[model samples]
Target: MENIGVRAKELNETIVTLRRELHAHPELEHDLPFTESVVVRELAKLGLDELKPGLGQGHGVIATLRGKKPGKVLALRADMDALPIREETGLSFASTNGNMHACGHDAHIAMLLVAAKLLADAREELAGTVRFIFQPSEETVDGALSMIASGALENPAVDEIVGLHTGNLWEGLTPGQIGWKAGPMMASTSTLTIVFEGKGGHGATPHLTVDPIVIAAETISQLQTLVAREVSPFEPAVVTIGKISGGSAHNVIAGTCELRGMIRAFNQETDAFLKRRIRATAEGVAASMRGRATVMFSGDLAAVVNDKACALKMRDIAANALGEEWVKELALPSSGAEDFAYYLAKAPGAFFYHCSTFESSEGGAECNYPHHNSKFDVNESVLWTGAAAMAAYALHWQDRN
Candidate 1:
């Protein structure tokens, strides 16, 4: 195969332009009409074999390209959704639409689109079929499941899959570097809502009230034991209470207190144990007091476990396409969650991370803001690296499989 990095570099300007355009006008969740139109317009120029639009409730677009030879089918995916954050990057193309591409979804879209063009141009050399999945609502952790339910993974019956994320979380990797892992790459995530019910009364008369605020405070303190004492020290588990709401005024004690949080665990056993312990702890703590607690789990995402063979194959392909120095094996799994786990669950595949942080040209501090932060931005220079990696993976996977 020809040097994919060189070919991708030839289209660097185009990739950067498309990324900036996406950054300027960001959309959120499944309501990405404009984003979908932009993707369709760019893909229409590629002359794919088949173009299927309005997938996953009108936000997803799947394009199929058939090669001259017959072989195994492979899928390449990219998410297209922005976070509901006001932009604070102060860039020339910063979004003004009140939504920000804080998680680098803009880069993901641009890189995938460019990869699509590269793959389409080399269709004659490709074997079997390649399905390009442009997914939506990834921030809500339901986009991949939605697309799967809509039959995005069927038809050609993908033999394997590949995907990438652009971010600065892999701190050891510099700009343009790619990081991957063999097994579990990310943790399973679930939202936990615990409500403590108690009697309401004036603050001055605390003896007459059950005082849910006190019970909630105690419950929160006790919940820490679930991780430190209940879960094994070897396994990583996190239980974070991000939001707590109950009281309306200072004088009156509220009848109910709501605690909203997230739970993350790498393995199913650890995850199950955490959930069970959380509920038991909350109920026990509240019952010991005069109040009662209710626990509910929702919006759960499975851990992203990459196939070992697929991961090793990608490492080799990435080294050949982007140079050995640009590829590195990740030492640890990220506690962050991803809906892409759903896709990996359906098919054997690998998910890699692209480092996008670089020193500022203006001599200012490097734009190293983490994902979901208001000021998050990626070094556009490395955008082509991700595109090249995906393109190379697709071309090489068909032959190897």
Candidate 2:
């Protein structure tokens, strides 16, 4: 087998080019015609065994590379939707459009494209088939479900799958490192909206009006107890009220108040319990305050759980391809959720992290920005490490065990 790390290094310029091109013209969820065209054009050059464009009832691309020998089919995935944020990175190729690839999806697509190229070049000696899944609407957390529903998993029927995420999602991980965990890499996430209805009146007449604002405040304060007191101390959970709105005037009591928040938990049972309690607490508090409350949930996704064996195989593959020092087992799971959990539900696979943080101590920018930040940027110099790891996994997974 060719040294994948060296080959990836040789293709770094191409990787950077593709990444910049995609980054400059970032697109949002559910409407990514431009993004899809870019992906299809690059993939068309591969001359693979099969290519299917426009999946997910929208813009998702699926390409396949068949090898000479028969073995288990592997799926490599990369998401292709940017956030609705304004770009502030100030790169030479920064997005002129309002959207930004703040979560590093541009680099994800570039690495997977280069990985596809590497596997396509060695198809004669490659074992089994490689399915390159360029997914859309991942920011909405429905893209994976959309593709799976539209037959992205059938035909070859992936025996296992693998994907990677980049940027500063964790601490203690330096640039170029690969972070792997055996199970439950991310928490199940859902958003809750609570609407409190009350009577409108002047602020001076506090006794006459049912103040939804007071009820909303009390609910937010009590929701914190769901994680600290209700859940086990060792279990990881988060209940955050990200947004709250009420009242039009400072001296007027509004007729209604709305609170929007996120619920994150690794345990399904715990997640369910928390949601139930959250609804109950909100309604109960509103009733106690002489107001009516309604609760709604959406943008829900399951936890990202990795197959232990698959994760270990990925660790070994990264170690062999990028050197032992580049591979590390993650100590904890992220409360942040992913749509990739949808793919894992259908197949046994692992999601790995490619650390691409920049540090001022290393003469790089002091960028501790988390994902989805407007100023978030990656250490592009070591991006080849991800391409090498994913490509090496497809080549060596069947033979590794």
Candidate 3:
């Protein structure tokens, strides 16, 4: 096959223009009517073999490009959800709809669309099929599972899968470089919702009142020690109390107090351990304070563990499509979580990081804010590298088989 780098570069402006359109009209989670339409529109022009719409119980689109022969199926996925944040990038194309693409899903959708175009143009000589998944609701951790339930993995039945994330999530990589890891690429996310119930009374009679607020505060403090005291120092974990709601008036003690937070870990065992400790501590603290407690887990996403063979193959293909120097191994696994873990549970796959970060010299520190932050943005210069590498991986995955 010819070098895909040159081809991707040729389509750079098209990719950028598409990304801007998606960025300006940001949407949240699985309800992606506009995002899905944009995806379907671009994919429909390619003359692909199959175009499935309205999967994931909402607006998830799947476009399949079948090669000359029937062989293995490789699915390339790109998430299409934005965070509930106001845009602060101040670019002409920045979203003004109150929702922002702070995590760069807009760029992900653009790169995948162009990559599908690249494959469709050369489908005659290709040996297998490429399934392009434009998924929604990644932030809520429900899109991938919902897609699978809708028979996304059926029909052709994907033999393998792959996805890529673009941003400054991983450090030590320059713009256009690719980051690959063999195992535990990302973390598990578990949400916690706790409520403490007790007797309410007038604030003047402190001794007669059973204060749920005090019990809730104690539970929060104990949760802070679960990672530091129980887990090994080498292992990484996090428990964040993001929200707390309780009393209404200063003169009266509320009957109940609620606390909401999130837990993150690199593996299932560690994640489970944290959950157990949190439940026990919250219950015990409430019981000791004469206030009953209720603890519930709302959602969970497992850690992303890459398939070793698939990872090695894609790394070499990226080195070939881009340059050897443009491909590098990541030193550490990220504590952040992704719902792509659900797809990996169904079949073997690997995730790659496309560096769209800007150095201080290029755009200053402000332009390179961490993902999910209000001011986050990507370096547009290297958008084609990710598209080229993904297209090249789909083209050459059969060689190793």
Return the top candidate by TM-score: 1
Off by over 4 Å in 3: none
What is the C-alpha RMSD, rounded to one decimal, of candidate 3? Answer: 1.7
Model 1 stretches with alpha carbons more than 4 Å out? 360-366
Q: Count the backbone clashes (under 3 Å) in each candidate.
A: 0, 0, 0
Instruction: Order the candidate numbers by TM-score, best to worst.
Output: 1, 2, 3
- For model 1, how does the per-residue alpha-carbon lDDT over 48-152 read when each residue is reduced to its tens digit? 988888999778999999877788889999999999999999999999989999999999999999999999888888888899999999999889988998899
Model 2: per-residue Cα lDDT over 298-392, one tens digit each:
98899999999999999998899878999998999888899999999899999999999886775555565778988888888889999999999
Q: Can you give the lDDT of residue 13 in candidate 1?
A: 88
Candidates in order, TM-scores: namely 0.96, 0.95, 0.95
Q: What C-alpha lDDT, on a 0 to 100 scale, does residue 26 get in candidate 2?
A: 94
Model 3: lDDT to the true structure: 0.91
lDDT of each: 0.90, 0.91, 0.91
Error of 3 at 373 (Å): 3.3
TM-score of 2: 0.95
